[model samples]
Target: MKKNFYHLVTATLLTVVLAGFSSCGEGKADQQAAASQTPSLPVISLPVKTLTGYQSYPARIEGVINAEVYAKISGYITDVAVDEGQKVRKGQVLFRLETQSLNQDAAAAKANVNAAQVEVDKLKPLVEKNIISEVQLETAKAKLKQAESAYNSIAANIGYGTIKSPVDGYVGAINLRAGSLVSPSSQTPLTTVSEIDKVYAYFAMNEKEYLNFIMAADGGVRDEKIENLPQVTLILANGEEYPQQGTIETVNSQVNENTGSVNFRAVFDNPQRLLTNGNSATLRVPKTYTDVVVVPIESTLERQGSTYVYQLDADNKATATEITVKDEINNLYIVSDGISKGDRIVAKGIQNLRGTTTIQPQETPFDSIAAPIKKSFR
Candidate 1:
């Protein structure tokens, strides 16, 4: 009985060992299949190109001429000829005040003047014949002058009741409506008129920028004949580029001591009247960097504290290439080191990749993913 039990136990052990070996083989096969099925990293080819250096800052749209129309004399407003946003020309009548009192005063003055003229006519013969005292004739002449002066004063006051536009512009908010009392000393404005045909954009830059610009001008680095800087771009509030270009018309003589910035003003021709006063915009200023290689910003990758990019090799493997970024111009980054002209650098998909990774490269057109640029260089 003991011998039979030992044989059965031996047979069970062999079968268990065989099952374990088979299971191990199957696990290895599965692992091999998974390894073979793993997808490869995608490859992208980017071209090397030269780019201009530019600086962008927030700017605002301003009308070259902004005016506030106010009442010149004290009276009740009877007529308002223009509404808000109404375009007007110079000398156009904006509002008319009640002039009944002035008119009545002028009529009374005219009656007095007529009476004085008759007295003067009657006294002229007396004075010429020496029948009346010289003092009596002088009194008549003085009365005629006083009446004429009163009539002229009333006429001038009546003219002041009609308010006219000082410039050709578009009307702004109407502070006073018809039948409202207005006066020369009133704090309320009747309305505002802004000239939009040619508008001004005002902005401020730091002292460093101001000094650099001055140095460039003085050193002949920029065109010496250019008294006013040409070609300024206007970006609208909605981040849209304005079709019209502007010129730098004025620069402040002194920089602000507290802000350390200098004020600048640019003038733009606004034929469409699209830009309004106080609308914010961005000003794109052109600058140049020397001896630098610029590449698409996407080509760079950050790892730890260092920046890198993938460079392709003959075996279709990507090696991490460390780069030193100098500055960013638009969508491109200027590299001071670690990249050269004609070197193919990966433009996208650098996040999920590493050194010595194999890839299948596909060439993409540079212009398709390139950043939007200005139509012409300044």
Candidate 2:
């Protein structure tokens, strides 16, 4: 009976060991099934869209006429007739100098002129009566003419004391005030008169950029090239775009040696007097690519200063490919080469994945993804 009990115990132990091995084998099989599952990633097909890119440069704003007002004579400023930013007409009185000294000089000159007139009248009678020699009468008349000329010169100087506006425009700054001494040789101008009905925006481009601008234009002559240039936009100091569009008017004949840049002038109409002299702004010139292949900026990866995108094949295998980017606009890169239309690419979730990773692609609409990004940028 004891022998029979030992056989039964051994059989029970053997069955328990076999069950443990079966459980371990099933657990590993489940883990392997989970690891083999493919990750689902968003993918997109390359689309052709029109994109416009802008190149910005620092710019200076000035009125069409930046006329500097200077004093023509030496005197103390007695009266400042106009204030800063006041609208003025041509020939309007701007300032008046102390004319007391000039008035005294004119009085003395007038007395001399009266004395000369009396001498000329007496000489004329003597010459007609033949009482004095004709040569003596002629000499007296010449002296009278000289005296009259001196008196007229003094009177003209008095007129110069009242300074007038040289042009019809708005006043800029009042440098010299009442009781301040001014002269023709003064380095600073009394004021600036700016014609702001139209304004000019000056900007510069490097030598290579200028050459490309001229050569890409559809004209043979310089004037025609300027005419063919697209209208540019002005970004004000506050980062707001100006209401008016500006046209390229003139280009400097020679490039600046010190800066190695060519200057360009663009004109804009200022109806509400919003622009003024010496205002700072930015000039934005646009270039458009029509029906070009573009990729979203979010899908791009920068590796060593070069842009890259993961391209997908028919078997859903990703391969990192380098693309040539011509420009960027609205959160998209204008693809010039390397990838073309109808090409499939991994849109997002590429951080963990590397070369030759097979994926289960979840197709997403390209426009739906791009539209939101474009709106945010705008």
Worst 10 residues of 2 by lDDT: 369-378
Q: Candidate 1 clashing pairs?
A: 59-281
Candidate 1: list runs displaced more than 4 Å. 1-48, 133-136, 217-230, 288-291, 296-326, 336-378
Tens-place lDDT digits, model 2, residues 11-130: 999999999899989999987776577778899999998767778889999999989999888999999999999999999999999889889988998998899888888888778998
Model 1 residue 189 CA deviation (Å) reads 2.4
Q: List model 1 lDDT by residue over 1-378, tens digit each.
A: 999999999999999999999999999999888767443543445445555555666777767889988887899999999998899999999999999988999999999999999998998888889999888978998999999999999999999899999999999888998899999998878887899998888888899987766675533533452363547787677877899888877788788999999988888999999988778888866655665566666777877988898887777667899989876766666788887866665667777675677666666655545566333232
- Clashes per candidate, residues 3 or more apart or on different chains: 1, 0
**TM-scores for the candidates:** 0.69, 0.87
C-alpha lDDT score of every prediction, in listed order: 0.79, 0.89
Candidate 2 residue spans exceeding 4 A from truth: 1-37, 129-134, 373-378
RMSD of each: 8.7, 5.1
